[model samples]
Target: MVEAVHTAVAGRVRYRVAGLKRAPELKKLLEFRLSRTPDVTHVSASDLTGTLLVCFNSGNTVEGLAGRIAAIVEEYRSHGGGLAPGDNPGKEAGWLDTVPGLTPAYEAIKGLFALGGEQPREPWHTLTPEEVLARFGTSPDTGLSAGRAREHLTTYGANLLPESQPRSSWEIFFGQFQSLPVALLGAAAGLSLLTGGVVDALLIAGVVVANAFIGYKTESEAEKTIRSLQTQVRPTALVIRDGRMSEISAAEVTLGDLVVLRPGTYVPADARVVAAHHLSVDESALTGESLAVTKTEQPLVGVDLPLGDRRNMAFLGTTVVRGRGSGVVVATGLRTAFGGISTQVREVGETKTPLQGRLDSFSRVIALAVLGVTALVVLLGLLAGEAPRTGSEYARRFTWARAAEL
Candidate 1:
């Protein structure tokens, strides 16, 4: 029994209880329950113990995830079409009404944490490209889902490349020289040189290089700014692990990790403060309000409070200007409010600069003009007798009959 408890807490479990006479029925019931819970990615049943263990991916909120599991347990108990003691099982010690509107799975887990007064931790330091690829089972050579590939590219840049992966600003800058636009520009310059327009060719080459340089610089600066923001804010969060207070890296946090916040430290992740001592945070990044907003440890009156009005919540990337508090980390990368903003920025994409648009329009116009001028020049020269000069000279040299004989 003690071993089972440890297994349940340390990992995950699904089970069915039945008399020895009903063992076959129990197996059938477990199978039916497992099949119904499609979210369970893996399931293993033990005939000896009549226990089923299910594993699921982290796709939904903790509360939702747990609710799904609870539902499965209840369904298994009621599989014989009759109510049993376990059918309407008493609520778990650490369970709450699933957060409204969340998936059953997310609600279940989050509710567990809420009732237990547990919080989430920050993530480990930002994952490198290789680590991310390994986690997702992506290969440098193998193809990936378009959406996933794009996400990886946006996050890691040339680090996705296996060799000569660009890690610094300068390497990234130089990498731009190898793109299709640069190649096209080179072709244009070569054409110009062959046509004996050395000056024009050189000018065109210069423009292409300059444009590449500007684009590289802008991207580099944006990355540097984001890194600077990350560096400047040093947030110390108090975390309880194994029932002991410990100070740890703010980024190496995970969902449901408890955090302690104090005046003057930034909130490292999205959290609901379970305890507060006159807590307040400067949420200018999220709300555009310049003042320090007060917070409380009480359950929020409304579930749908706008981020700015979530008086019981503290968000990632915000400053705690006054008071002390402890909260649970509910979300992290691509999940936190700041992470959401980052995702949105990536989704909107980088627009071409005004100069780039103008240059593109100008180039198209010039190309058409050159083609038209070349045609017009050939036609004019033909009309001026320049094309038939040899024929005319032969005609002057001999009569029609003499030219034919020759």
Candidate 2:
């Protein structure tokens, strides 16, 4: 298995594998294998570092992407074939291949990546209240007709955060063992077990298991907290549909639907203020400022104001602490600022901690020291008349003998 090297904000993933480095033939074989995978936009392998970077559509999950690469690596290790018939490997190089530089250039290209291609965005904040209403195919006097609302809902899907796919408990538990320190410990335990120091091996494995339990428990709690916060967002919304006001589930709210907001209401989507009566929102959920921010319907003059200063917009997850106002929903779900942040959190790659880095270095040093000691012990044992066990084996056997005597 290869380690995930990097992942860009736009869904490009890089994997670093030492086995394929300097092996041009193998690299080409891998590139060919990956090219056939579905949803993979591009594949590139660097001969210098044996790094394979793949770009996929936004819909692809990281786990699925990594599994695909692992499968390809396994295939190369097995049959080890060249490019299949009629497979011109050179044809797969995307525009990214012609570009200079590596990670940075790929990131720039991915930042502009769009799902289903980009759609033009209307500057609703620049328009007047009446103008905004007209553009949405609705009016101030009457909201979207029932039939129109249904069509919008079908187009936009539900206004809700996509639930994360649940990982099996065994997978989560096993993932903890991937750390460098754990790997070293596992090797030590294996060596101990081979020498018959069962107690010592059990103790080392116990530490590993304890560490995994702590990590798993902490992650489970954090997930529960996030779910609680999501539930706090208003579950139901009051919207004017079919020329009449009705209470509906927040998920039923659609674009161009005229939403009704008042004190104690949580905005269901990112919206532009159309009408307000001293509208003030407690945006602390987003801005972290306890004070309520006042909002106005008058077109904001400046384009570059912080979320708190925007004054004429209401974001999802923020509560209407005071006054009353109505805004046309502009963005919802993952399109909202809150939703974008959530997406980033999910896609964000794990960074090595300072201690983890030191541990990695320590692991290398330990590996070298162990190899040297093992070689020296083997040489001395061979020089002696009777064959002797290796250093670790000798230690384990001595411990077992002593325990039996006790």
Report every candidate's CA lDDT: 0.52, 0.68
Ten contiguous residues minimizing lDDT sum, candidate 2? 111-120
Tens-place lDDT digits, model 1, residues 202-270: 776677778778878887887655644433333345565445565443534445455677877767777
In Å, residue 321's CA in model 1 sits off its true spot by: 0.8
Question: In candidate 1, how many clashes are counted?
Answer: 35
* TM-score of model 2 vs. true structure: 0.55
lDDT of 2: 0.68
- Residue pairs clashing in model 2 are none
Q: For each candidate, how many residue pairs have backbone atoms clashing (under 3 Å)?
A: 35, 0
Error of 2 at 221 (Å): 6.7
Q: Please list the residue runs of candidate 1 whose C-alpha ends up more than 4 Å from where it truly belongs after superposition.
A: 1-188, 196-236, 242-244, 353-406
Predict model 1's lDDT versus the native: 0.52
Candidate 2 deviant stretches above 4 angstroms: 1-120, 196-203, 206-234, 303-306, 350-406
